[model samples]
Target chain A: MKYYVCLMVVFLFSVQIQAQKVAVFDSYSDLEKAVLSDENTTYVVNFWATWCLPCVKELPYFEQLNSANKNLKVVLISLDFKNQYETKLLPFLKENNIKSEVVLLTDKDYNTWLSVVDKDWSGSIPATLVISKRKKKFVEKMFSDYEELNQYVNSIIN
Target chain B: MKKISVLLLFVAFIVTAAFTSIAPTPYKIGDVATDFKLKSVDGKMYSMSYYKKAKGFIVVFTCNHCPFAKKYEDRINDLAKNYKSQGYILLAINPNDPEVEPDDSYELMQQRAKEKGFVFPYLLDEGQKIYPQYGATKTPHVFLLDKNRVVKYIGAIDDNVDSAAEVKVKYLENAIAALENGKNPSPEMTKAIGCSIKSKK
Candidate 1:
């Protein structure tokens, strides 16, 4: 009887966890409303994926940036597959203890949204864009340290 | 009976493995290439069919963000200039999601193309539907096609990702040369290095 109850409890818990919400953006308008609404709040949008080694390597800097900058809004968008949200993405986020607001991109076509973010983008990961009311800065290279990321962000904010 | 069942299960596993390993890539050597009508840096339309009469085409999937791709930018330009008159054309495609990677946008692509003096057409694959069709897995992925539009070679430009001196194999050049001479390429495909081609969600 005890074993049966334990088994039932385990199944219930699994169902609850599986039902947890996974972020998916339908359009740029959806993303803008969620994370980019406040013009006064400087936004740092980091594009990354689980399979990308450089992206994984630089994730800590994003975390550090989010924690250190109270005035800035850091959004870490995972480019992993929507189906793998539970299997791959959620575990990664939990393991890293990522504190930034996490969202998953849901656009099926790259061209449609490539220009939506910036006309200069070339569909690369580890790419970052810093947006303020007055100015916007985009960097397509990976950063080795928080200092490099901070320098770029500071340049824009100032 | 038990032993027979075990044997059957092992056979099934082996068959499955073989099937998985032998799956054909989307693009292969000698296949008629599809023309892409994509936007170029100058806001003009560029298509592979425009150069259908060329000796060969070097289609590269590259992006602005990857250090590996950046390292080979000058080399690619050199290749374009050296071979353009010889009926060789270079076509670069950027297939990343703009929302996720705003720097890969068409405007930035134009700026980078002009800034780098790209002799080839830097086209934008806005929807990223074209890359997977070519089985491009990474930035700086090279696909060499002969005049008949057969993919003669697919992979990296060279063996080294960091130092050019350390490059033991010039895969792209070698393949192009072999095709020109009507000879089969020695090392047709090699492992490509650089950023994974960004896929649309």
Candidate 2:
């Protein structure tokens, strides 16, 4: 009976370790439902990859932005391979102490989803799309500092 | 004797200062090669029209910041060294927004050219207006133009970004070879991977 309890504890711990803190969505409908269900809320979706340097650099700024603005919903979508979810995604979130909802995008066709997100996006990482009630702005460029990001966010929010 | 030495030192400083301030003239491929009067690092003004009698030119958009651009720097030097004598002059252009990316500035461009031992002319595109005209989205984007200044090829240096052996297609080299041999290049356009050309607002 004691041995069974130990096994269960270890299994639960391992399961918790594998699950990432960020919410990942595999389908557009689910993502839309999560964001659109809240009418007054603004959603900031940042598409990033672990391998991309600019994406990694701008992550802290996004975290700061999310913490400061409680009313805004910030979603960090990791474009990392689905197979490497446990190996790459989970550890990155835990290590960074990322508080924002994180999710792994499972779509294989990049161009299709890229166009879906915003037609102006050139399929680049570190890309951000600000979705408000009836306005949307997409920036497909990399930001070197927090001020640059804040400027864009402020423009949309205001 | 002390006064004479001071005067000599001042003259040397003035000469060095003048040399450092010199910037190369910028130009885009597919456009008619303009007669640029910009000064070289050696304090000599070079004109593209002087080389108009040549077979063609290879215009490369590259910078110091991007790792992808750095990877092809040595290869670019080798290509320039090899082909410049064959009537093909390699003109490098730095089109990144200077305010945002200081490495693409005129002084840094000169410093990079000196450090890389670049034999080709590295020009600074100040406002970044010329990059988009040529449709250069990425660094190390090559534009191979014929004698008539028509764009013959636009794309990556090759298919392999990591290793030369893995390259299935040598786009720039193949285009140059075709131009030299009086043949139309096969697959004249291809997608290149590198940092986007930073544009000025």
What DockQ does predicted model 1 obtain? 0.06
Taken over the whole model, the C-alpha lDDT of each candidate is 0.77, 0.72
**Chain A, model 2: TM:** 0.80
True contacts kept of each: 0.12, 0.00
Candidate 2 lDDT over A1-158, as tens digits, reads 99999889866764574463555677655766765457677888888766555678889989788867786878888776565677987778777767677777765443245567776554446788888886778887777677878788888888
User: Cα-based RMSD of the predictions, in order?
Assistant: 18.9, 14.1
Docking level of model 1: incorrect
Clashes of each: 20, 5
All models, DockQ values?
Answer: 0.06, 0.07
| Tens digits of per-residue lDDT for model 1, B1-201 | 999999999999999998877434567666666768888888888987787578888898888766668889988898889888889888988877766777788888888988999988888887776887786766888888877668888767876555577676777888888888889887766553257666543
